[model samples]
Target chain A: MKVRLIDLYVAFLKIGGLTFGGGYAMLPMLQREVIDKHGWATIEEVLDIYAICQCTPGIIAVNTATMIGYRKRGIVGAIVATLGEITPSVVIITILASVLTRVQDFAVIQRAFGGIRIAVCALIVQSVLTLSKKSITNTGTVLLFLASVALTLIAGLSPIAVVVLAIVAGLIIGKVKERRAA
Target chain B: MIYLELFWEFFKIGLFSIGGGLATLPFLYKLAETHPHWLTAAQIGDMVAISESTPGPIGINMATFAGYQAAGYPGGLIATLGEVAPSVIIIIIIARFLSNFDKNPKVENAFYALRPVVVGLITFAGLKLLQIVVYGEGVLNGRAMIAFAILVVGVLKFKKVHPLVWIGLGAVGGIFLNLGG
Candidate 1:
């Protein structure tokens, strides 16, 4: 079924604005809006799009919106959906940045933000733990995880370079397993 | 000049930052070191707190924050546009020409390995941020450490509570604990 570009924009705008904490939090809301509400894509299609988002670069939520938009209407749909998704962030953060700059020097604001910084670090730690639980499953993956951490933390390799190495390592690992099985 | 630089830098960030929103933190850390005027080590912590507390993807939120810090509202717009441009272009190319790329075994294998590595990158970024918040000018901030410990426990125990709540609690804790200084 064809979806209107305006409808696509509004749908994604709601998805972007309402969801909090980003990442997986955006998924269920996304499933509801596109599948149940708009009928833009089916469950299987959404899952496929989601998987594609995972391996690709950029933000997963934005990528998912782009792929779905492309499916619904084409390139223009992709642009519209992506714009809708980020519009909220651009507007909200811009406003926050402007206002915060004015009063940021206040002692009270400083103190509050000090606490907020702690909370932010805790949040990242939580994310690391949660991501590790899912990604570092078996021995090979565990080694890959450790090697990556050491490469960046100890060897001081750039993350982009490490990403490339990991891809090559994965391919070699996959090839060796295939050879052994054959 | 700054506008172009912001756009170019964020464009690169968009292209390379994989896995998820938090993945951008590693690149931002590098960027902070290179362009401390645009974003300081201390501000990175603020950016994280603000980005997590607000709506939308943290990556996009951060791009906006950095852009605004660099060149005001126009910079924010440009940086955000630059960040999303690569994703839009790449996704369109894949959707139009490489629709089955995700199903390719080679691609599958790469991602299988890439996932754990991305986790590592993010962990490294998290540790860096922890260092920034818990340390002040080559010395440790004991108050921030206490707040970090408490929040870590709070987050683990109340896994379902929205992060905003925890952030709010942290703000209150910071004030009472005299963390502002």
Candidate 2:
């Protein structure tokens, strides 16, 4: 099942151009095009790609597109698909950034932004709740969550360092648990 | 020089912002702290709104927006390239090998610890934004507070509604409610 580079580009282009809010929002469209429409990959394959995308350090949508394209047509496929995916974002945001900056000083725009700002706050709160529901499962994780919040908010520790420390903590906890089980 | 800096900064953001698009918020906030001339806290609020409403990854859009602010169109291009370079390189290498990286026990445990902490980081960033928009100068803005309350309820209740709808309502309300700050 050889997929043309052009086909890969077009498929991801539609995926990128249509989906809003990114992340999981792009999943349905991705499944539709890659699995249902083109048969480029199976459902399980798409799910696997998604799992990899979650842990990987990049935009999930771009990662998904890159992985799928790479599977279909190697490195060139990955590059082409990535370009297709980001084209919409670069174009749309560049235009909007230009226009918004120009008209940013207007009072009406300010008031609109005022309202938009509140909406943004609400959106962030929802994400916090959603992520907390998924992440805070046990007492250990609870402590980790609280400590992280305190470190960032109260102590002003760098999050990058916190992330690194958490990785170390996880590795150690995992090793200890493995020893106990053995 | 700005382009190089934007490239380097976003490259770091791309390399470390694991979890998802929202995960980039903390790094962007740090960017605001370190390079206030490039962008500000208020501009980040606006970027979130625009990114959510637009058709793209929020992380990429933010990088592009910030890059554009820093330099211009070329800056946006360079910043985006920097952001995606790591993804392209890492994923390509993994795909070449074609193994299930997530199946490893150590990888699984690392994620087990990573998720909760990442959530904490995102929560902190959200709180900072909330403070800036709803209580800038330590004085609560009444209209923004009311809008915030209503939107929170709206989001929780009408979970199916797209964010664009909420943003649209907010814009209209901002104009009509005279929510000028």
Best DockQ among the predictions, by candidate number: 2
DockQ of each: 0.77, 0.79
**Candidate 1: lDDT of B40?**
80
Residue clash pairs of candidate 1: none
TM-score, structure 1 vs. true: 0.95
lDDT of 1 at A65: 88
Candidate 2 at B31: error in angstroms? 0.3
Q: Give the range of the ten consecutive residues with the poorest summed lDDT in model 1 chain A.
A: A18-27
Measured with C-alpha atoms, the lDDT of residue B110 in candidate 2 is 87
Off by over 4 Å in 2: none
Q: What would the per-residue lDDT of candidate 1 be over residues A2-50, giving only the tens digit for each residue?
A: 6889999999999999877666779888988999998888998888898
DockQ of 1: 0.77
Off by over 4 Å in 1: none
TM values, all candidates: 0.95, 0.96
Candidate 2 lDDT tens digits, B59-170? 8888888888888899888889899989999999877774878787888898888999999999888899888987786888887888889999999899889888888888
Per-residue lDDT, model 2, residue B178, is 66
